[model samples]
Target: MPGAREELIAHITEKAVFHGDFILTSGKQASFYVDLRRVSLDHRVAPLIGQVMLDLIAGVPGVSAVGGLTMGADPIAAAILHQGAARGVPLDAFVVRKEPKDHGRGRQVEGPDVAGRRVIVVEDTSTTGGSPLKAIAALEKVGAEIAAVAVVVDRATGAREVIEAAGYPYLAALDLADLGLEA
Candidate 1:
């Protein structure tokens, strides 16, 4: 049987990896993109993503929740919470909007109470780490202690440096190298 990492990678490789000239969220031009939303939203791969992400944070201490910027982080956070529940971990999940809502509460971070809890921020694919960093800032504003930044794929450009420079550990399940793409 394939290991969890292998299985997740296989699924991502098969379904999510894309090759094309595209402009990324960062406004940088890239020859390829790893669009994980396709796999993350799939019933088959979502649980696997959760399991793998759960494993990524299992050894870390005091992680009461998982969350990140909306869209990229949504499915991953939900999957982690679901898997955590099944395993008796009971983690809460949340989303950080790109901007605080203009209406009721005007909240940027939404979900269960996260104040005073350690959090793991999830991202689907990271290039410069802006999405996770935005999530981190929003979470921190509400007093959420960031434990780590976890991503499904790292483009291996400047994301690691940006994330680490901000004082949090970073982890990626896969990267451009894994998909045989140039950084």
Candidate 2:
């Protein structure tokens, strides 16, 4: 897990997944960024990420499944489910919609039935942690027990306090400091 985390950190630093000063969702801007899909699409990083995330939250009690909001959670969930099967742990995966649909099945939670199951939300990066919290509300509304939350990187914007205040442990494989970017 440590090696995989290190590899991810190295990739992010060297590749510099950044561009011009851009406005973040929080309307704040600096000189750096991390478009995780770049790493998520890399076959090597993808699988290694799955292993690392799984290990990070393995000690969280329950955890029958894994997932988060659609686009961000997609790759992580798939990787974790696949690797979990390989290791014989067999975790289910699901996606929480940004908004509940009004047509067809009219579902907000997609993939598997999360009701009565223990779940964890995953994020590629967390600044204020709003995205995962939205998923958490949707999941718990459907009766899923949230055991913890994990992120590949913490953008150092009080995410830990926000999540912990809501009574969920926030786990991170790397913070900005680990990448040599101070909080």
Candidate 3:
């Protein structure tokens, strides 16, 4: 049997990859698209994603929480939180809204307080890296030390370069090649 990461890759390739013309969040055109939500939200695949992503961010030290921009990172963070607990890792999850709420404490970052804690920003897939960077900005305001930026699928666009150029370590569990696709 394949290991968790390999199994997760198989699931993504079989279920999430779509061919033909597509437009990405980055406003770029592509011949293929990786819709990780298709599998990331699946019952069976969620745990696999949790396991694979846990392994992906394992090396980053002092990580107390995982999260990113709300919509895409929501399920991914939940997966990691559950899987990390199952493995005795004791991880927490947070959410970064696109804008601070006008009501109810007027806060942007939600969940347990991340102040003075280390966090790894996560996303379902990365194209231009805007989502993670936006999350990072909010996290920083709340005093969360960003250990790294991680993604389940990297489209091999300029995201890595953009994140790394901004001085955060960029970690990706799978790339286009792993899904038998190309940039």
Which candidate should be chosen as best, given lDDT against the real structure? 3
> TM per model?
0.94, 0.92, 0.98
Which ranking of candidates, highest lDDT first?
Answer: 3, 1, 2
Task: For model 1, state the Cα shift of residue 178 in Å.
Answer: 2.4
Candidate 1 displacement at residue 99 in angstroms: 1.5
TM-score top scorer = 3
lDDT of 1 by residue, 84-124 (tens): 99999989999999999999999999999799999999988
Please give the lDDT score at residue 168 for candidate 2. 93
lDDT for position 157 in model 1: 76
lDDT of 1: 0.90
Clashing pairs in 1: none
Model 2 misses residue 95 by how many Å? 0.6
Candidate 1: residue 136 Cα off by (Å)? 1.2
Candidates 1 and 3, the one with greater TM-score: 3
Q: Which stretches of candidate 3 lie over 4 Å from their true place?
A: none
In TM-score terms, candidate 2 sits at 0.92
Position 156, candidate 3: lDDT:
91
